[model samples]
Target: MIEDDAAVRRGVVDALEYAGYRTLEAGDGDEGLRMALGASYRLLLLDLVMPGRDGFSILAELKKKRAGQPVIILSARGEEHDRVRGLELGADDYVMKPFSVRELLARVEAVLRRTCERAAPEDKRMIPGGEVDFSEGRIAFEDGVEEALSEREGELLRYLLEAKGRVVSRDEILRHVWGLDPAKTETRTLDMHIMHLRSKLRDKAQDFLVTVRGKGWRVVS
Candidate 1:
């Protein structure tokens, strides 16, 4: 959790702890940004308005470096723009301030549950001149070289492999991989990560991660 307000931060942390969830918190954006970038956590609870490096800025950085992270924004701003911008920046959910503890907890549970359900199964895939070991999170090439994958990249590849070569829409990718509703959010995060994954796999997006024109993407090979 990252909140500037002491009372709200304490209350939320207490509630989460009471509910059997362990949490790490920061009182300002700078600290939160450091923790967000370095720590290993299942979910992040962020405040939009902070002393420095606001949540939106933090979220943008996360999208670039940790796009698979699950995040929910807590903010006093209830304007359409605020909410829309958060979603566009790849936040999984947005909770307006003055929200009840009950409501907040419920949202937290829902997001976590959806994320858990999207967990990728263990498997390995054979690709051109190399093979991907999902369980090991690495690629073994014919030249005796290997490249490791980040957790997000592995999950993305796992999801694509699960599609069995069928075209999957961007909306479907968001729903299954990011656990966000495609209709409610606008983001190119999915496309960016897909491109990154292709580069890691040493395959062109058009060849391996096929663009289905008006649809989404498919792993053809």
Candidate 2:
């Protein structure tokens, strides 16, 4: 958990640990960013209102380097823009302030469970060259360099590939991946993610990705 406020940070971290998760704490977003990059964790609980390198900025930078990571933003401001911005920055979910421990725990478990569910073993994947090897929690390019996938990115790519040429509505992806419905205009977040996968799939470009535009996307091998 990375939060500038001592009370919220302590409360959240303690609750998380009590719920059976091993967590690391950071006083500011900068420290959180460092811990996130250097180590892989199942989830990140971030505070959008933080001192020195706010949550949104940290989220953006972390995504530039590791797009697959799962982040849950916690904020007192609960404005529509705050929620939208966090989701647009690739956050997996967001929790408004004065939330209950039950709600927090539920989101954490739900996010991790969803990630685990989509993570298929490479051996079981039927892709031509190879699968992303999601079960291993890394982006295994057929080229041999195994890049670590942030939890969300791996699951997003997996879901897209599994759509298998069928047009998947943006809302579906949003609801399924983020475990919540962001504003309708926030659908482009899905497009942004697709673009990221396309860039990552450098060599696998012609394999299974086909864009439908206006309507939705399909993966045609």
Say which candidate scores most in lDDT: 1
Kindly report which residue stretches of model 2 are placed more than 4 angstroms away from their true locations once superposed.
119-221
Model 1 regions lying over 4 Å from their true place: 119-126, 129-221
Give the best candidate by TM-score.
1
In the range 71-190, model 2's lDDT, one tens digit per residue, is 888889898988998899999999998899999999988988876677543433444455566777655556676556567878887777776666765655665677654343354566
| TM-scores, each model vs. reference | 0.61, 0.57
What is the per-residue lDDT of model 1 for residues 67-97, given as tens digits with 9 covering 90 to 100?
5678999999999999999999999999988
Q: Clashing residue pairs in candidate 1, if any?
A: none
- In model 2, where is the ten-residue run with the lowest total lDDT? 119-128
Please state the error at residue 38 of candidate 1 in Å.
Answer: 0.5
